[model samples]
Target: MSTILVTGGTGNLGALVVTRLRDQGHEVRVLSRHSPEFPVDLRDGSGLDAAMAGAEVVVHCASSPRGGDEQAAGHLIRAARRSGTVAHVVYISIVGVDVVPLGYYETKLRVERLLEGSGLGFTILRTTQFHDLVAEVVDRVAKLPVALLPKGVRVQPIAVEEVADRLAELAVAAPAGRVADMGGPEIRTLEEWGRSYLAARGRGRRVVPVPLAGKAYGGFRRGGNLTPSRAVGRTTFAEFLERRG
Candidate 1:
């Protein structure tokens, strides 16, 4: 059995990937700040050598949601080089990250470039916004009776489970350089889904569709953050929301 090293194993996506790998019988190792506690955050490079010692694959899943500090990606590369036995590095990125100029999306794009230039065997899977995001938005909007959203913004939101499954498959496959993008089965306007979501929760919140301004808003309005052709995920927003309750 091959040994695999996972970064951010304690996170939502990373935890699923680690669990799936272990279930498949691969010897799994997780890199973390406290290798003995919480078990996630080893990209600091302190315990990387020990974490990656015998692993043949390294799945890079650690990411700052709001985005900052590109140094973390560099550290992972350094650790992999030091390990000297790593065969593949799989990176999980968001769909249309290159098109969106948002700070966090920019960071993800930069990490993709780092993977390409590192000269290591690598695979990059770009997926769409996850359905979990809907829950987050609801929670944020619940504080106010009115929620402001960008008008005409389209999104192909996939299930988090779908993204996890794809990550697991990439972790075990040969480095594909860059794989075809993946997204949810359908595309919907942000307003449409937001209304459906609030109503489902029995919340009579007013969703104001404001014309979004700035690079991030422009990109989203232009459908730069969505995947129209690579719809591979099976779960729907309605299904996900119902399941959440």
Candidate 2:
């Protein structure tokens, strides 16, 4: 079994990836500032070299959407080189990241570029929004009298576990550059998703659609966040709701 070093291994997707690697009998090293396996700061690079030593694969799941995602990826790339034995570096990215004008999305694109030029065997997997995020949005809107979402924006949300499973599979296989995009089985607008989520949970929140503008929202409005052609995930939002219930 290969030793895998997972950055951001304590967070939602990263935690799931860690579990997947462990279940497959791989030696998993979790590198996060607060991780129980190995406490390392992705920003400072403290303990990162040690965390990556002898690791056969490094699954980069760490990201800061608010900002600094590119910086974090750069740190990890340097740390991996210091270790001198990492055979592959797998990066998790979002669909349409290059098209999105948001700061976080731009940061992800920079990381992709960094990995491509790192001279390391690397694989980048861009996936759609996760079901957990969709549920969270519904819950946030539930706090208001009416569930409101931006207009003209569609999302293809895959199950977080499914993405984790795919990452694990890639971590163990030969590095393939920029694999096929992974998407949910269906695509729906934000309002449609919010309404269905509330209806599924038997909540009575009225779903309201609000117009969105600006370059940031422009990408989403034009379907930048969707990958209908690659809708490979089996789980649906309704199915996710049923599981949570």
Instruction: Summarize candidate 2's per-residue lDDT along 161-244 as a digit string, tens digits.
Output: 999999999999998999999999999898899988888888998988899778989999999888889999999989998999
Task: Report the lDDT tens digits of candidate 1 across residue range 34-85.
Answer: 6782244433556666677777999888777755436778877877887888
Query: In model 1, which residue pairs have backbone atoms overlapping below 3 Å?
Result: 32-40, 32-41, 32-42
Count the clashes in each prediction. 3, 0
* Model 1 CA deviation exceeding 4 Å by range: 37-43
> How high is the lDDT of residue 103 in model 2?
76
How well does model 2 score by local distance difference test?
0.90
Q: RMSDs, each prediction?
A: 1.7, 1.1
Best by TM-score: 2
